[model samples]
Target: MPGRNDEDNKPVAVTTSLFMHPASSPHAKTVFWGMLATRPDRRGEKIALLLGAQAIVHMWEKEGARGFMTGVRQDNASSAALCNRLGISDTDWTYSVCIDPEMLGRKNLTK
Candidate 1:
């Protein structure tokens, strides 16, 4: 669903992409929902809420996802609020990310 073009002739649109994937951990029943975002121009419209809920249900029913989880940055109030509205509660889970320095053209340092 492409929207109006910007001043630079680039197409701008409101897109919600569901990134639910199987958890790589030993817990096979968990699904990791990643990167749920909505443009500020379309906030307060319950778009994120609807999309997330629908995706969760589909994953649970059709994909055998027993648990759904996502991480929100501590400073992102809007995302936190949206998650709460979608009946998602905070848990004891901690989200961690690691990137290899070589991926960015740097060698790993060993002390």
Candidate 2:
């Protein structure tokens, strides 16, 4: 739904916990979920990248967060382009590992 917003048509705040690692740093930081939604009415890769960049800027302002970390499957060109626009260079290193397989299981245990 292009150009559609919730009743108010205003931007929604999106965030998620993401693991981080630097080449020289020994530890990682955990921030909230990164936003991944459309802007007002734009389309295609440009819009996606704009939204992605805006989300990071928003979080940094609101929560004092440092950076962002997001991933897309190998073939998700749109998302890949968006990430690229975020100025994320170098595909290196690893981050936190899921501790509980059940957390990612099919069943919605919390429900």
Candidate 3:
């Protein structure tokens, strides 16, 4: 799948709100590298690299970012490698999401 369509033109990838760190946090100016996944057949084309670099650079210039960071699962070697290739470093920090296991796949609307 080339994942390109002049017909529908829907977005294939999304950048999420996880990148929005709190202003009060010490790492406020740090840019979170939001990674995009290409189709399995499209891997190694460095498409992720191009998009990531653009997003990172835009944030750096627009927000005056002091550093860049991202959250990748410890088991995700590919993502970690991309992070490194983009000139970002991994931290000892752990990212956790608190949600009830039973609530998964259900509409848990919480403000």
Best by TM-score: 3
lDDT of 1 by residue, 8-81 (tens): 76543332323344357566677766355455555566666666776777777877777767777777777777
Question: lDDT for each of the candidates?
Answer: 0.60, 0.49, 0.61
Scanning candidate 3 in windows of ten residues, the lowest lDDT window is 10-19
lDDT of each residue in 40-102, candidate 2, tens digit only: 344443544545565566666765556556655566666566567676543664555465767
lDDT of 3: 0.61
Q: What does the lDDT read for residue 86 in candidate 1? A: 69
Return whichever of 1 and 2 wins on lDDT: 1
All candidates' TM-scores? 0.62, 0.49, 0.66
lDDT (0-100) at residue 109 of candidate 2? Answer: 18
Enumerate residue pairs that collide in model 1.
none
Regions of model 3 farther than 4 Å from truth:
1-19, 99-111
Clashes of each: 0, 6, 0
lDDT of 3 by residue, 1-111 (tens): 122322357543333212457889887876655546654544577766766776777677766777776777677777778778888777776667676778575542110
How far out, in Å, is residue 46 in model 1?
1.1
